[model samples]
Target: MGKEIDSTITFQNLSQKNMSFEQVFQHIITFMKKDPSGNFRLMFGTDSQVFNHYTKFITGIVIQQERKGVWACIRKVTVPRQMLNLHERISYETTLTEEVVSMFTKDHKEQLINIVIPHIYKGANFTIEGHIDIGSGKKNKTRVFVKEMVSRLESIGLKPKIKPESFVASSYANRFTK
Candidate 1:
């Protein structure tokens, strides 16, 4: 049922004009046959960015048919920090100045997360430093990467978080898949 309704609506209609990302989102929920009827949702990014770009992240959405409407949304799950860490961590170098590391140790962190993924709301947030745990698989690959990302985020006066970013990413992923 959900699939059938979704098939009838072109993704473009959900995000073609200057409608704020929220407006387009509303159209999607409404057209998809919402029971409670909520055609308005707002996110802090472009609809195209959030949607239309999930394959890049290797994620997908799964829509579960509710008794009368669609689900809240769910996506292929993974480690919040792992996902935000980005593959770039694989080639990161760990040579932070003692002063820089010390400064950060005293400050908070930011995290980068993927928001609405599969459906077309490919979202990402960068705050709360994603604690990188270089698994025993590699030498110092992950260690270096985490150090680099932290330095980069600090350079921009930002921090990293894992929870929010992960939640957003999975939510979008589920929506896109649906």
Candidate 2:
């Protein structure tokens, strides 16, 4: 829902900067091509931090090859004022992840899938996960919205993960929300 979802937006990781979304897509495809036999999880997640004046939201896109390596990049959006409500922040985070997910058209996903289909019987697998920065544990304050958030992601065809298992949101993207 923010400008970061636009075609002109840029995504960056440690070794790169100002990379267009197309470049990011190509990067993932190239990584998979390098090891088509590896299990890949293409995940999207967002985390936010409420600064004094604004909330900094960061959405991460990661292509992880189990027991191997990963290629990840993040897009950022900053709201003009601090977002104090817990539900609002969590919902906004999901919205941000959805925005990034919408960028990968059907053809783009097919391209990635085609690369691994040949190696499927060889242990190669692919899954798309939506990681929400909320937990279902009783002690977790975000537990209340877990169902809603998970359902939102599931409606988009993604397997949803949360809390301890949602490393992309709870760990990766969170680091930059500061």
Candidate 3:
């Protein structure tokens, strides 16, 4: 089992006040089941912000239906600061993402893909991808980590995305960490 991280998820369009993990899972499942013809994509990503004494990490899950926009849930956690280099920071972000994806997929594997329509393949079916907050370019300190991060994600059968394409982590989750 991976380290248990506490999370609070807000289901945008739903009227529910507070939702448990199971409830969120059910909500997503029901949403997919209700629209069997809609194209769907599930993405998971994490981003972190460092403060003088601690670091804040935010992880997000996005469920998108073709042209219908998206519904997402975010979890934020703050921990004592550690002197981590750029590589370490990116590595930690990726690890947190892996843990969240693994936890979700462990029990929801079948449910995640069972409802996809056979002919509506506009994007990935049920694959959970990781969006790292790193980019290419010699001036970017994190650039050297792109290959390593991608390989790490690939080792666990996950697709990886970096800057320019990794808006989920660099943009979406980054918003909450600040």
TM-score of each candidate structure, all chains considered together: 0.24, 0.96, 0.81
Off by over 4 Å in 3: 1-18, 82-84, 117-125
Q: Which of candidates 2 and 3 reaches a greater TM-score?
A: 2
Model 1, CA-based lDDT: 0.28
lDDT-best of 1 and 3: 3
lDDT of 2: 0.94
TM-score of 3: 0.81
Superposed on all Cα atoms, the candidates' RMSDs to the truth, in angstroms, are: 16.4, 2.7, 3.8
- Stretch of 10 with least lDDT, candidate 1: 41-50
Which 10-residue window of candidate 3 scores lowest in summed lDDT? 5-14
lDDT of each: 0.28, 0.94, 0.74
Ranking by lDDT: 2, 3, 1
lDDT of 3 by residue, 33-86 (tens): 766667776777889988899888888777777787777777665779853677
Best by TM-score: 2
The CA lDDT at 106 in model 2 is: 82
Tell me the spans in candidate 1 whose CA falls farther than 4 Å from its real position. Answer: 1-144, 163-166, 169-178
Off by over 4 Å in 2: 1-5
RMSD (CA, Å), candidate 3 to true, equals: 3.8
